[model samples]
Target: MTLEGALIRSEGLSIRHGGREVLRDVSFAIEAGEIVTVVGPNGSGKSTLLKALIGALPPAAGRVTRRAGLRLGYVPQGLRLDPSMPMTVGRFLNLPKRVAEEGRTRALAEAGAQGLEDRPLTALSGGQFQRVLLARALLDRPELLILDEPTTGLDQPGQAAFYQRLEDVRNSLGCAVLMVSHELHVVMSASDRVLCVNGHICCEGRPEVVAQAEEYRALFGTGTGGALALYRHEHSHRHDETCELDHTHGEDT
Candidate 1:
């Protein structure tokens, strides 16, 4: 997608954890107001790539370069709110940073967490917690927003509503979005571009284009709206001419 800025580029990014090579030669670019989704099977380093983009995990190889003064807002896989933390949703949103009451209210309203203002952080459900986190991220009015599996634990309705809210916020703010997700159909439908990663980038292109790639098939396999062919199929049968030949010899044929 065309953006005002130069680009957020990762040139040949790689990562290693405990001496194990997790991601290798990974690279991609995202632009302002663009939504990019990184998809792959479990343990394929999808989240690792996101973490690297946000500086949570430094790449063992390659580098991530972005525009100057690019404010980033991150929504991790899940919020780890302690049950003992005595904080309301409103107060929690302002932790370690100051935000005007109107701003907080507006953000929460946009994220559909308005009623949760007075509620304890622990009292919210998965969807509610995610919304509040999104609101918190919006408080900075960042130029870019990064989400890791942002739709996890939400029902179909909740997922749809969340995406609608995000779209509204993006339209008004004109901020770029980079989200990691497992909801294949939803991600493919919403993202501007798709980056398929399995230890490395299998393919990168528009959703339909990448989805049809041969590498996508080899990586995501048949479950991704394509042929169900796999590297190998397991079976318990063998029909060979060698066995028939042996049988004929034994039978004096």
Candidate 2:
């Protein structure tokens, strides 16, 4: 991807944690008004990469650059709440800072939580809680939105609904979306691009292009379609084997 017009871009980025290198020589970019999904197996540094991009973890090498004065919104995997603490959804959004009623209303509405302002934080269902978290992220009307495994605990239908909400958020806010998700088949079917990372980027391209690759099709299925289809087959591949596909896109990428 071209870094010139990208909202955020990483150049030869490397990261380490607890004295072990987790990611190395990774580079990619997310442009405005686009949706990109990062996919990989467990312990592959997908979360670490997001943390590094958001400045939660410092890179061991290279750099992450953002456009001037860019406003970013981030939705984390989950939050630990004190069960004894009583707080309304609206009140929770104002924590560490406060926003006006108009902003809160708009954010909740955009997040598909229009009438949840008065609900207790602990009373929400899994899907409702996720929507609230999404609403919290949208409070800033960010130019870029980031989420880390946003649909982790949800079922198939819940996962599909959450992804649909993501599309709505991107359309309404006109912001670029960068997220880490285990729901690869669900998101890949709708994403503009996909990044397959295993500590480092093994390969990346438009979902259709990568899905159509004979190499991938032979192992993963014909394509990443129908949210539940990939569940029928096992998704296991040796990263070393597909690392060479990085150049497979070449001039087209």
Candidate 3:
């Protein structure tokens, strides 16, 4: 909330696409070494916010500021590699920038995809491919890791496993994480803070608080209320990692 040493901050940000405003007056700050999840229904500008944060999209108004000399790594919601391209995992990791073999192997191992270097990119299953993408992001040892729905196609168990692996990565690297996810059940349990968005931030707080907020319930309905209840019961026993002080701040409109 203080914005001191924030890794990235958006101040009254707005975005436009195709002559229509997608987001308006949205603002938040991601601090160092915290996990923040953005949740919204489809077309709520969740992904748009991510692109703007990463500088892939220009803001129509307001500003996105990053700490000086920030190192950022991004894992997109989906990547379409041409099936015709004959690329191996090792080669893929070295794209645009070449990494030493040792670094590549270590990153892959950390992403839970060890020994996948020589395998063709086409040969990997959906889960393995996601892990490889995570490996690529880790190559730079980023100070801020951004993921846009990195667990799209995985099943429930697989999604949990992937998030667990992500938690491990964040712990070991000591990097802040900003992710956009639709999985309320998983994100509520995993995140340090959760922001609910509907073209603008509706509510934000520690997951439990947001889950109970009228804004969140109005958007997601009582169906997910059960998930939040389940999360409260299981979360204490699950994530043993310590979180930084809760820094959730936003107007609950």
Candidate 4:
């Protein structure tokens, strides 16, 4: 079921890695200005799904589609810089091409690393580095921003802060965001929708509802049932404008 104004969607998607099926029969769509998070246990094909959406992987079956000429920005999981080579944030953003000063500054400010242009990339803390990567991803003014486990090694507080900043960026840019993470608090509070995966999409729905799902509990354990309290955010308005149907459904991804 392809959505009328979907920014990106997958239909009966199946994928393989090294002769083994990693994802199967997955289907979902993300509309403009939506924040969708993909969560699952380790080796559950969370990252593989993201790769498939962004056209990095070929499907063994099914299809993935994007809006024609869609502008995309990607921040891969745990991007590391060689410490031996020194590079400033400003210099780094100019790589392969130069970005206008106004645009670069805006991207940096949106990511909450406003004065980091002069800082060495290697000198940044884990949180700061993630912000820089986010800033770089935002430089192209993407209509859909994709991330894979962007908060790999941040502390609890750092992870929370990054997700908050991500929300702010989404609002400012009015761009759809699709990210893969194990952050359950984000599933409950930050994301407009959630997809829980294990080989395939086990379940998907609204944050609080999915958090309490039996399938989610089975994969993540009951310990995460209470993680919803870690970050609490309420919506004054409903998501009907962007969500065609209630995502609190136990249907497809």
Candidate 5:
């Protein structure tokens, strides 16, 4: 795919932690208004790649380029909030950066947490907390919204609902989304493109094509039969772009 005017581009990018290389010679580009999900087994450098793309980690080799003054909003894999410290959702959103009341309310509403403004952080359920995190990310009207496993603890129904909200957020904001997730079914169902990464790019393409690739099958098996069932149900309602799929069988990094 032509990645002209890419929001972020990496060429032959390599990353290292301590003495071991986490990712090597990886190249890809995230264009504006695209939803890209990175999937891999644990310790496959999925999180490392996200950090590199967002400039939280410097590349040990090659380069990562971002659009000038790119606005970024990141939702981490998990956030620990002290139960003893009293903090409300409203108070948390204003921390360090105070946005207008109208903007705050609109952001919360868009994230499907409209009435949660006054709720204490500790009072929210797992799914509600994730929505709050998303609300916080949307406050800045970011150009690139990066989420690392945003739906970790939710049950199947919750995961599906959250991903739907995520798709809604992307549509309403028109921001490119780069998220790391292990929920194959949800990722495949919602992504515009999926990248199967295990230390390096394994295979990347549309959800349907990637699901059938041998490389992807090798990493996550066909247990996704249920996921595929869900995909067929959802697929009938949407128009998917027709693009040639790209598959890579690189040696593990």
Candidate 6:
């Protein structure tokens, strides 16, 4: 099942919660084999867009088109672990089903949760639980993966490794990924396209180009005078080069 054309499209989409318009007229498309990341600060409607995409929330207005027969694997913003649910990691992987021995092992290993197979889901720390959920996402071998804030509550190394694992899964499954993330530096290189959302798409483009936009500055707080610093350095370098050349010629004359 190839999704070469647009697999997901939103046109004039809007959502209102508690009489507050969280998203308005947001339009975007995600294609097959492409990784499109939604980036913005908290309360910026990033998660709202994800919920709308996954059919958890209906758009108050507009259209969302998902390609027919496309399977979606979603990891929501947080995994609510229940201490009372005495399910082991392995059981969680095969949740609501009888586990096939081989399938259970493969999923755990792929998620880097092999050693955690017998541990209860509630016993796992934040990072462990994140990996467990990721393992579950892989079970169906979805055509598209939607991850909302995948790295939340993870340490730096775990976050980096999680992305690396995602890259591996994307390659292995040959599925597209749509992720909501604030860790720009991590996803910038991995993403095929970037969607910057703040109420609506402030901008969407290649990572490097989007990184330079004013909207990106407002979104990432990274372009905060960095472009000016770069320009200043370039200006200083040219000035120094001209001075050196002039001084050399004067000495020769």
TM-score of each: 0.77, 0.81, 0.82, 0.79, 0.80, 0.77
Model 3 per-residue lDDT tens digits across residues 143-198: 99999999899875577678778888988999999988865433734578887666
lDDT of all predictions: 0.72, 0.77, 0.79, 0.77, 0.77, 0.72
lDDT of 2 at 153: 87
- Candidate 4 TM-score versus the reference: 0.79
- Pitting candidate 1 against candidate 3, the one with the higher lDDT is 3
Cα error of candidate 3 at position 189, Å: 2.5
Q: Please give, for residues 1-253, the per-residue lDDT of candidate 2 as tens digits.
A: 5668899999999998999999999988888888888876667788999999899999999999999999999988777579989989999889668999999999998888889999998999888999999999999999999999988888656776677777777887899889887743334355677787777877665555344555445544532343321211122445554443432332122
RMSD of each: 11.5, 6.5, 9.3, 8.7, 8.4, 12.5
Query: Against the true structure, whose lDDT is highest?
Result: 3
Off by over 4 Å in 6: 1-4, 97-99, 184-188, 209-253
User: How does residue 228 of candidate 1 score in lDDT?
Assistant: 16
Give RMSD (Å) of candidate 4 vs. truth: 8.7
Report the lDDT tens digits of candidate 6 across residue range 146-236.
9999889876556666777888788888888998885533353467777756677765655553546564455435522221110000111
Q: Candidate 4: lDDT of 218?
A: 52
List clashing residue pairs in candidate 1: none
Give the per-residue lDDT of model 5 (tens digit) for 212-236.
7665566546544323211111222
How accurate locally is residue 241 in candidate 2, as Cα lDDT from 0 to 100?
49
lDDT of residue 174 for candidate 5: 95
State the lDDT at 190 in candidate 4: 53
Clashes of each: 0, 0, 0, 0, 0, 0
TM accuracy, model 3 = 0.82
Residue 136 lDDT in candidate 6: 83
